[model samples]
Target chain A: MKPGTDWKNSYRANVFEEIPCGIVVIDRNLRIVDQNLAFTNIFGDGRGQTCYEVTRGRHTPCAECLAEQTFRDGQRRSREAMGVDPAGKPVHHLVQITPIRDETGNVPFVAALTTDLSATKRLQREYQTLFEKVPCYVTVVNRDYRVVKANTLFRKVFGEPTGEHCYQLFKRRHERCPECPAEQTFLDGGSHTSSHVGITRDGTAAHYVVSTAPLVQTDGETTHVIEMALDVTRLHRLEAELLRANALREALVENSPYAILILDQRRRVVLANRAAEKLWDCDRSTLIGHTLPRRAIACRLDEIVGRNGGPAPLVDSTIVTAKGVEIPVRLSGFTLHPVEGERSTAIIAQDLREIRTLEREKLDAERLAAVGQTVAGLAHGIKNILTGLEGGMYVTSGGLARHDEARVKQGWEMLERNIGRVSALVKNLLAFSRGDEPKPRLVRPAAIVADVVSLFKELAEQHDLVLETEISDVAPASMDAEGIHTCLTNLISNAFDACLVSHKPMCRVLVTLREENEEIIFEVTDTGCGMDYEVKQKAFTSFFTTKGSGGTGLGLLLTRKIVQQHGGSVTFESSSNEGTTFRLRFPRRRLPPPVEEEHNGS
Target chain B: MSREPSLHAPRVAIIDDEEDVLTFVRIALEDAGFTVEALDRPTEALATLEAFRPHVILLDLLMPEQMGVSLYTELRASPVLRDVPVIIVSGLNARDTLQEASAATGAGPPAGYLEKPVDAAALLDAVRRALSHSGRGTP
Candidate 1:
């Protein structure tokens, strides 16, 4: 071999065999002249063969061949082609063919450069599948707002939105959106997000959150906007429903008749109903989130705490009003444990003043009825006795007319006795009828008993009877002290009179004061000539006196009437010649105030 | 010719269940120079009214068995005694019953109704007024 020729061949072999891309040199007849190792590896080593046969395994020249085009036009040409290799695998190639001349101005050869695009084509197919199958709607639009490409969901949502203005398909508007995110993305080449309500081609409305990004080409030019829209109509509906429910609950609580107050774990007032506002006589807005005032009416805060802390059992208390009026109330509190954090207490307050007033009225009416009945019966009996006295007087007057000294003196004496009897009866009646009104005051039961014992001491001594008292130091009770004094005096007098009739003539009257269930009890017990069944039955009945000539029989009846007015009751136990015990019990609960004015003009 | 002198005084009968009231009225009528016959028993006094033929009859209300209103009703039912003027004296608080009874009775309800306990002068005046109205001479 010649030295220059050897060097030229060695350089050609090294250059042709080592190139990374597939290279082929075709002659003017469109035959393969030279090829690299990569080209043979890709096209299966066909030597001196037609270019179409070597690359495509076809016997004839390839249709629309770049080399042929380049040879004819003497200009570089490039085209995309699909070819088959020796293994029957399909390959995509981008081929560039250029004419080469040997300084003679005549085209001698075509150098064809082929770039395999199979990997790039496969990637594009995968991207198309992802775009078609994604759940969210995806679309591509040009800068002019015209849809360039759309996925299946995008087409289904906007009905083949391609080639149409993106705003027309997504917003069903004739014009572009004023602040479209896609337009912003195209301008800035950045991603943007927006939420808006859109109408579909079928006129169905939907809420959507759309994200848009600029699609930048390899030349760094943003030619399209890629948008992804997510539907959020259901979430919007849920938020609306929650708001409605909250409004309804607020309305119900505000209008409730019961005084309702909601307090946080820290005992601060969080919410209060209109009733609570009215009850406290404070503005509702001012009460919210404020610590409960110490001077809450109806009951002291400490007393309520003593009853039970929230959630408290139903309890009764007296609440003081802003005006310092104490009112009876029932307070109940319960804890509300919501799904979220801290527990709160809901307190309900019910006013009890009206019910208490009604109870008092009923008791007053019953006492009036019982007293009226007794008065009527007493008046009837007194009238009968008066008639007897008058009858005796008539006989005495007739006797006096006979002019016998003995008869005259006897008649005078008899008239004197009957007159005295009638006078005593009138006195007793007057005493009972007077002082029906109660003058209530705080008094100790023991003190009243002591006073009665002292007042009756002389009478007891004269009658040879023993009168003693046992007093308790329990809390004082409110009552009509004068009325109770009268009651005790009458009982002691009766006991002294009874002792005079007993065999031993020994009278023992015991007055005791005790406390039971927070009630003040006064017991008057006597051991002297106890009454029989018949007398006991008529003991409290007016004008049924057992003391033949002296007794007026209004004492026990009046005693019971006064005791009943003080929210108390009187009961007795008696046995023939053994003993008689009268007990009066007064409750510690305060009496209700008078409902009606004491005096009426009518 | 000398007329036979009247031997007995004309009698005025007073009926009441109350003895003190009866004695008081008897004294007043006697002092007024009229014979007074007071009876405690309504039934007995009614018999005396039939026998004695009192110029005026005073009736007390609210008596046992026969009330003043009922007694007045019985008297008016009799043709002979119905014309005799009757007065109702009552101690009851209700004057309506007395007025109603007087209006219902045909005999003009005792020339004057008196309430107990009747004063002496008032009782005398009532008796005189009743007798004078009946055209009867005082005893």
Candidate 2:
């Protein structure tokens, strides 16, 4: 059982027959001398035929035949070859040819041991396809920074770079990029990544992120680098657009006229604009990372945070600045979502101090104008009284000189009448000129109407006028109670006079009180002699009276003043010889605020 | 200032809303020997004025029910009274009231303007001057 002899017998019986790869023997004449089963299975029995005829179905010996070289030099040779099988299907194999010599060691045959490599070749082909068809640019560069190899996508994007430097092929630059990742990989034999702008075949810029990996030799020497570059031009464009939009938004917020405050979810001020700092009389550094300036703004922000996404209506509020000065402001709020799942609240405050001041000045100007008009009317009234006094003096003196008793009595009567008128005029003037703020209290409007009505009820009855009330239950309001009483009394007394002047046997006076549209309304209707065109034209003017010698002409004026103080209006409709209806409308919201009890007590 | 009334005494008409003014003017004119008619209401003054056929007319600018300016305009339009000299007496400013009345009525200014508190002497003087201006003074 010697090893060498046993192996030769085993090789014929088992090794050669059972081997998975194809094997064949050929002579110097280029004929197939012997073949293994694996070879027969592939080429289908090639005995008595040339090796090229069995493997390639060729009639002549193949050019550059490895077995012919082995037979001439008595050496061994190997090569990978492609041929057709029994079924004419493509086969790939690796052949090893060794010379088989006789005892003389000259002019010998060769055995070509073939290994079927069709499956391995198929796998290699698939891998090659994958490498070429990858979406990104792949390049293999040598130590000199030249692209030794490139993939299909690289060739298409950068144009075939046979021996061109990677920088020149990818960036169209004659010099290497300063921060080249491939150079770093070559230095350290480690992977590196960097972003670059490459030029495409179409002469357009292509943004890419390139990763460089060292292709190290067995000796651990870094010779070349493999670069995998992902095109990110679209992502870069998107990022640039987003940056522009963010910058524009920031500019708008900073330059807005109204004060803007952005509060994070924790109700801390994350951002405050220049206007906000100015309004609060503070610096942005002081405001940032802090809560709202005052309770008013904080309360509004809290309320808006509850209502996600939309804007809150503007509300009148008061804020205290850093210097402790209270200012009126109109506040509006919005809930903003700058990012998903993150919430913020924005408050916009509009300063109303200037507007309030303007309104007050306008009111003062109107009041001054009214006072001027009233003074003119006062002059006219005083002159008329003076004329009456002068007439009395002239008649009394004339009658006394003549000793005419009847004329003297007549002149004395004139004097008395004028003196009484003067007293009345002075009293009414004092009342009209008393420009005091209203004393507001919580009182029922209907009660004031009822009080005035009751005061005039007996007079109305005596005048044969049917006086009635149509009062509905109404809410109490903040108002000047005595002022309202005076207004009602003036209106009702005028109604009685109108009825008397009508000379009608039966006259009706109706007073009604109601509430509607958040306003209190009182209306008085009289079936009495109404104003003519001239009387109506001068109804609200100074010292213009229908009741000559009886009216000081201050009743309507005082009533109007009182109504205006209560933030109410007086309007009347009258038709000559028919009737007059006067309306007093008071909106609840506009009514004067209630006076504090302490002040009232004082 | 007593004078005897004669048949040729200049007749004067006074229209005013104030009864005291009307009475005083009437007595003053009567004592000066001019025949006078005084009416308190402007509504009645026009008819009474036409009936009295006064040589001069006195009008108050402000009156209830109707403005005296309008009454004066009506009197000017009256065929019989259009020639009578009309004087304006008002509590308002005399020149302004007269100008306003003249502008509003599109008529000539009144014979004289008198702001109120006008005394008896001034009233008599104004009346006599108006009568003379109309060429109807008592001889």
Candidate 3:
């Protein structure tokens, strides 16, 4: 043999074991294959083993064995096969087999070579599983809007894809969705997201949020787009419902009749309603996001939050409008639901100024009617006095014409008595009708009663009436001292007159002054001819008089007016032919607060 | 004798709650040559209506227990006193009271309407006209 020819034989014998490929030699009996080092590393120790058993971990030769065909035809071929390594891990291999020739040009041995492809196969499987198993719907669309790949989730919800168009599968249409984000991505080579509404294979509506990203080729040419979508129909419906509820709440707050305010926990106004605007005389733009200007509103808000989650009760206060008109209001506060993740407070206020004005009008109407009735009563008394005057003058002139001394004296006395009555009537009328506000001050009841009784004692003596006083000393109370004195005097004199007209064996009048139940009571009781039911009904009413022309019927009226001016009251209890008592009560704490005149343009 | 009838004394009945008004009217009527009877209580005046047999009645509108309108109703309802001439004497404006009384009584104005604080001459004149209008006496 030639020397160069012998080198090929030497190279095979020495270099076959280091070839990196798993090289094995098998005879026609498929036994005793020699494998290189790389084969041993992957399959482990294949010397003297059957070729089928060593390469494929099989008991016999494979049914379509490449080595058998190579041996018959002396051809080389490659294919893939799977087996397990010694460690029981799966191994995928690409096997190529060739024939080795004998000296007569006959093949005696076949060579089988294998490359391990297990890692590449594992990556492919992993990708497939990921595509099918993810929770969101995923798909791949070609430039023609065809669904080239669809995940299991997409298939489950929409239907198994059959090379149909993306628009046809998702929207049951031949055309694409308007302003398709996928189309925009293709044009710009950028990613885009959009919300889409479509119908499923089941003909049910579906809402989805889809994102498209460019899938580029090696030359940076975009041929297809990959889409990832989420089925957001349920989430979208819930959002819509929440928006509707928010709108309803806004409408209710805006239209409420009561002045409504929504404040943050920090007491800043977050919302003010129309009524609140009108009540404060400010618009919503000025009111919101600002602390209320009025102290009354601030105080009420503090009361509510300061209590820590409880509602505030109604409170009466005066609020000044933006126009600086002072108006009365009744306000209440309550905890409102969290607004925009913030703790909030709600306030409701009634514009009591309208109610106050209405009440004042009603009182004015009643007072006017009372004045009208009083004028009528005064006229009746005056008319009766006029008749007395005319009679007295006539009798006096007649007595003078007759020149009778005793008759002249009698007529003159009548004239004098009538004149005195007219003066007293005028004084009582003035006191009753006067609108001067009583200036309240502290006074002692016992001392005032003693002083009043002393002045009337002489008159009582002349009338042959007994005036007795039972006064108990007490602490000074708040009242108008002059008005109380006047009321007491009028009552005492009335009682004296009552005693004189009673025709009882003993004409007695009792006066008492004391304090009980936080009230100072001045009582004047008389044993006199008491009144009947009709007199009782019309007692304090106007134009009613039991004393005929001798009384103007205004003395008791004036007494009552004075008592009321002192934040007190006058009441009488009378029984016919038995007695009558008038009680004047002055409550200490009942004095009205001093009126402060409100000014505008502040 | 066909002489002036004003010389004869006529009976006058005055009912009023005001003692001063009753006293004044009684004296004036007596001085004007008329016999007078005064009652303060309207309820008592009802009892004396037949016994007193007055030629002219002076009725006051406002009184305790009964109003002047109610009293007039009572008098008109009575057969014995229905024919007597009534003169409404009121402290209220005489014309207004007469209008109201006339409407309530379903009659024309009374024989005479006298508003109080009246001049002495007006009193005698009203009574005289009331008496003559009743065909009971001449003034």
Candidate 4:
């Protein structure tokens, strides 16, 4: 119960014979006077021998003996010491020495008590290794911002900073960093963070993010700061590069000529370029954050860009103008790389109004040229008719003077017929020059062909030429009957002329009418002099004619226009000296409605 | 205005492409007491001319196979037919045709030029003038 008195009295009574720790009695010369069982177990019963020589297995007094100091000053002292155990293995212990003084107050013997501290010291060494080996630079600084202590990492990276300020060692700077986190930590005794630029011991640049924590005293006095820094140079470089690339990409997208729209994965407009703003006639601020209106986009956009018909822009598409009119456009789309969280799409649109205008102007010019050519041909044709009239009148007057009734009747008939021809020529010329769209009505093409064939039959007498027709009975279909009549007349006349110029004795002109594949086909062929390549190439060109003054060259052009209005086409094949065949095709379902100007204005 | 067509009339060869024009003109000139031989082809007219030995020729300028200007040139080159008067009748603009014919034949147009629907008067006038100018039909 009485620990000090009982335990001490017993140890003194038994002359330190028994205890858990090693006990020894030493004199002023640091020699052991007495030994106990624990001391014998530790130092091997070193009695009447120097304590250092017994415990350390040394032959001389040990350096800095704690018992010598205790004996000289008549005091007790304790220290951590290293010595050998009974097996001669190194042992770590806490050794305490007390002066055992005589009645005259002079110390003669020093009793030493030792505790084994090998396990605790081993744990402390492990903790110190962990602190030094951690990858990041770690250091403790005093209130003066000087590096008070540095770990192995800090010393390796910044060089040994035994007494130098942290800023001086890390950055080679003479003054403290303006926004030092360590200074803040010392002021508030709280953790602070900062990013800094510094240099390494190898003289290479280093970027670091430092976190400073207060190393507070037990009484909460913040006299020092512990700084832990993470080298982040690579991470900073990567972040800066990403920012520059983003800026460059934004610049390119914003400056594109076509309407550029960046859309989020949800198909909402994330951004709109300047062109997009003008094309949509909306401010970028208004359009950017909104989903694009469906009508403002083309339906064929998807088919233009990707497989499986994903969304994009396209040609033959119409864009809704600011005036609410739909104008045709050529559109294109691009799929941008998936960035961050969403894949984006971009669209571009080019307006086609100028092209359409140019097309219309070209058509108008062609029509005007046709009119001019038709007028020239008209003058020549009328001149022929006038000559015929004059000859007829002379014959009839002479016959009348001679009182010859038969000759007079023949001449009168000739005059009447020429007048009829002039009227027909005028009618056809008027029809062609009007330049109105065809009016489709139900009519039989075979009838029109027969009618055209009957118009010119005098060729049999003058030339070795023959005309024939092979017509198939067909149902009445939508067509411009009068226009077809003109077309047939023109073709038949041309065929007859071809037959006339052919030296072949058996020259023939054949007209065919039939229905094939729900389309009506009218073909006129001549086994006469065929057109050459140059003629065929210029067949549809305005005012290109080989018939000299006899042809207006408007016939085929008018035929083509009328056929086109009825959603049909006129094509021909010809070879020099072989033959010629022209075919006009009219699809039954696609005939054009009457001309806009043809209806009564009233 | 007939000067006097003798019982043996001066021969006129007519070459034209149009049959109707040939028929009507032949009847008109024949009734006017001139011997007329009509050929519908200028290519055939040269053969007909050799047989008929016409003292005068009426040529339509725009005949196919051979133009009248060229036929006129051929007649002037021949010793037998050179003295025969050639008159040009065309339905084309007469002044331009005459100029073209003159330029092509390298002879000054023809002995006479007539634009068609040459009435009986114009046809007879041009034919008679051509005959008189060449001193071929001096009835």
Candidate 5:
């Protein structure tokens, strides 16, 4: 059984039909081609049919048929074509056709080879989708930093970037970045990351975290660099805000006007502001952490806390600074409650010096206004009296020239009476001008009222005016006793004088003292020929006289001034021909602390 | 038979709202050897001035109804009394008001200005100066 020539040829044909690539043999007429198993599997049973009908399912030769051209030109040709498989699914095939002749120098048939390209086609589609849909901007650049390929986001963010340098689109610069991550990745062949501030295509500045990786070729050479940029503009803004807030807090604490001092739970100064340093007349470093002296800081926190009869929080208390100057301060504090094992208090001391100064100024202004009103009223009264005197003098002089003795005597008496009136006016004016400057000494108000009544009793008896005293046993008020005595005497004496012209010719003077609220009140009530509206209007005015030639009008003015100096007020209620009652109220309080002067009396 | 003095007596008019002031001025002027006519009321002063045709007039500044300045203005406006001289006797701060009134009344404020509480000698001197300056009588 020696192998015949047909048997060897048949065996080689079987091997060729089983090859992975599809094979077909077509005649010169472009008719049915001899097809291999792979070809029959791809294009389906092609014997006794045209090549176009078998591969393209077309009844005629396909457009731009290279196999027909190859038979005519006796040349070999290759092309990519679309074909359908037995399952009716589309396939892309790489096809090659070569003309074969049987040693006759003529083309008899063409053998075509096709390769399935569906796997490579699907892989390219997947790569395109990933490039387009990734969150970050992605770009591939050549060694020169020029853009080679960019995804849809990269093209949309920095439009049509191919053929332009990546630095130009990302950094908006003509030159590359000084420390470009892409260049570093190319040089190192490893991933490089950096934070960069860049300007976008829309001319907005943004911060980006850019990572670059080298794209290595088969020959171990870095051909391109891939860059991914993540925008971090909002994070940078947050960091800036935090830094600015910290600086503002420090500045506010340093420049606050109030003397602010922080004390630890042990009552030691921990922190002091600029105002505290100046108020204490010591450097901040020296005062901080020092145990506050009890005498210098007069306010005892224990006292206020005990008064509340509970576990007291930080309370408002007076504190004298290191300079030996007393200051009113609001001391508010709270325990650091939640901090475990931390037995500390946060205390803030706000100085009340400015408020005290404002109050002093207001009191001074009120005093001056009262004095001015009194003076104006006095001037008006004096002007009327002077006009009367001028009239009398003119009439008297004329009468003397005419030798009228009766007229002369009347003028002389008028002159004498008016001179006495003027003298009394001068004396009262002097008294009012020199108001009682309070020489405060602790004394019982009831005793003063009793003494005043006793002194005036004889005078009241002589004037047919009864004097009575009703004194209350109250707490002693600090005041000038002599001022109180003088005021009571003047009031009682006026009551006696008022009764002189009344038809009834009877008068009553009552002096009483009592304590109400935190104040002591001394009241003087009189029943006599009470004042009319006009007289009452000018009651406290200097030089206003209801007794014609007897009244000097400075009594009540002086009394009021004296009462006010003792931290008290003088007020009255009166009705025409009814009676008059004067009440002097003295608050049970001491004079406010003197304002801190930049320098003591110079 | 007695012979009367041939020398003419100077006639003076004193106008003031106060009767005592008018009487005092009359006495002072008469003692200085001048015939005087005193009018206490401002309205009556103008009538008395016309009748007496005085060589000098003493006028008080402030009065009811018609003040010294207004009376002076009215007197200067009349043709019959335009030549009469008026001396404003006032207790007011009168330096500025007198000057202003002098400009308003063409006859001028007075030959001399006198304040209140005027002495007899000063009053006599002003009358004499006014009469001599007006050429109405020899001082």
Candidate 6:
């Protein structure tokens, strides 16, 4: 083996073919003289061919050829060049050109080394696109809080930064922010996030959340920070509106005049207004979060929540306070069911103490007005009676002065009749003004009807009226016997007077006693002169007399008073020229309590 | 004044519900030299007054069978009795009632008013004045 031959073999094996680059040797005339395997694989076997034809697919050399410079200066030159393969596909590569020297050291050929860089350029383009078109405003900041680079979105919002601080661009602040996440990331070399209000180029505030990551180089020193800020202005506005609405609702519930209480599904009080506190006679703290006692509400919770498919009906009831005092109230309740969360019930209560007091006062006023009317009526009745007396005196004295017998007789009769009227009026007045409470005892209603019938029988016969009695089996009721008797007597007498004035030859009177619907009813029906509109309107009101000098007008009034005391009512039906019916109705439940029984020891 | 029928006496009508009131008022008017017709039932008063054609009428406002004011309305509406002078005598406030009735019916007021319990002289004086005011005074 020769020494030179071994060295050439080793050079081809180790340097020319084994290197991962395409190598080509070219003459000073831009012709390919020799090539490696990588060169042949890239340019497709270009032995003894012009370099421009093989690498550029051109008949002429490149405009700025580095191989010419290398051959002219006998020095190496490096550059990036775009060339094509035999298939006409362009390739990006870094090429280093060096002149090959002869034994005299004169420039003869140039060796060009090519490294393909297409994959690295594609990766660089992808990274730049991602950095420019991302949805967030991305920026790179240095240790001085200055913005070294900014993304497209950041430039659109804050304009171009000429080495300006990030605080100045993002927040338009002259000084650094007090609580900066970027500063924290720089110190700890960790990621951090914060929220801030930034000013856009148009001077509008932009709400954003910024996440900062420290950019540590190979030396592991955090020299820069990458900040990604997401715009949240619309979300911020929505949050503020929601808070305002919630505050308004709270204010409305707090200032309501009604006693409002909100209860959870378990019937525990959750919220109570000021009015509710006053009505329940308890503190707000005591009522809230506490289940009300059963006696306090005086009703079942289920009934209030289930009735009417909505709010419960208002009910007049009594509620016991914390102090065991009873308070009258009108109560109502409603339920609220939400799509999410527990269902609740709201109770509203109104204090009825003031209303009850007002009702009582109104009753008293009406009574006073009735009394005043009675006094006025009494005065008028007395005036008419006095008028009668005076007229009698006048006639009697005048007849005496004239010595006339028939005139004196007429005058004397008038005087006697008026005197009798006066006596009757006094008796009726005494009975009416007595106002004594009835001493009730158990008495059969039929017996009372029978007595009334018997008493009126004689008068009926005299007046040619057919008087009858109807008695049905009825239970005994507690009643004032004498008071009932007086009532019956007055009704019978009035019926008799009605018949006499009717001018009808045939008139009937019937007194009925019966039981109906747990009530004892005594009705006196008379076929007589019924009242007219004017008379009926004034019938039960005052001293209205229709029987000339016979009626004192206190009969029905006294009857009504007695009936009221016995917890009964008197009603009448009358029509002109037809008849009249006076009904005395006594409900069994409303009758006075029976007198206590006493027994003597034997 | 005496209880004798006189042809020259001024005719008078006394309307009341009470028999005693009618009797006394009639007697008093008759004693005062007037021919009087006493009416106990107001339902019958219109026919009687139309027949008697009295120079003066004494009306009681309150009555059971019919209101005297209603009867007064009929009298004032009557062709013959409309011109007759009516003196209201009642236990009620007859003047106020007449005014109220007049306001409603658009009729003229009564010639005179006398409340109940009036003296005989006052009643006679009222009748006389009414008769005089109506141009039918008794000579």
Docking class of 4: incorrect
Docking category for candidate 3? Answer: acceptable
Colliding residue pairs in candidate 1: A297-A319, A297-A320, A298-A318, A298-A319, A298-A320, A299-A318, A299-A319, B86-B110, B87-B110
Model 5: per-residue lDDT, tens digit, B1-139? 1123234777778776555455456645654567778775565577668877877778876553346677777777766678877776765445677678768666555666776657667777787777778876643
Residues A49-150 of candidate 6 have per-residue lDDT tens digits of 888888778887888888888777888889888889888889778899987899999889899998876677788799889989999999999999999999
User: How accurate locally is residue A42 in candidate 2, as Cα lDDT from 0 to 100?
Assistant: 92
Model 4 Cα lDDT, one tens digit per residue, A182-233:
9888778889998999987788878999999987555777888889888898
Q: At residue B127, what lDDT does model 2 achieve? A: 83
In candidate 6, the residue pairs with backbone N, CA or C atoms under 3 Å apart (3 or more residues apart, or in different chains) clash, namely none
Model 1 alpha-carbon drift over 4 Å, by segment: A1-21, A24-112, A202-205, A216-221, A251-261, A264-340, A348-602, B1-139
The Cα error of candidate 6 at residue A442, in Å, is 1.0
Residue B68 error, candidate 3, Å:
4.1
Per-residue C-alpha lDDT of model 3 across residues A192-295, encoded as one tens digit per residue: 99888888676778888889988754366678888888889899889999999999988888888888988887768898899999988988898899876656
Full candidate order by lDDT, most accurate first:
6, 2, 3, 4, 1, 5
| Candidate 6, CAPRI quality class derived from DockQ | medium
User: Residue by residue across B1-139, what tens digits does model 2's lDDT show?
Assistant: 6787677888888888788888888888888888888887777677778888989888888877678878877887899998888998888765765577777877777898888888988988888888777766453
TM-score of 1: 0.40
Q: Please report the candidate that would top TM-score against the real structure.
A: 6
Q: Which ten residues in a row have the lowest lDDT in candidate 6 chain B?
A: B130-139
Q: Positional deviation of A345 in candidate 4, in angstroms?
A: 4.0
In candidate 2, which residue pairs get closer than 3 Å at backbone N, Cα or C atoms, i.e. clash? none
Q: What TM-score does chain A reach in every model? A: 0.46, 0.52, 0.53, 0.47, 0.46, 0.51
Better of 2 and 4 by DockQ: 2
What is the lDDT for B21 in model 4?
73
Per-candidate TM vs. native? 0.40, 0.56, 0.56, 0.45, 0.43, 0.61
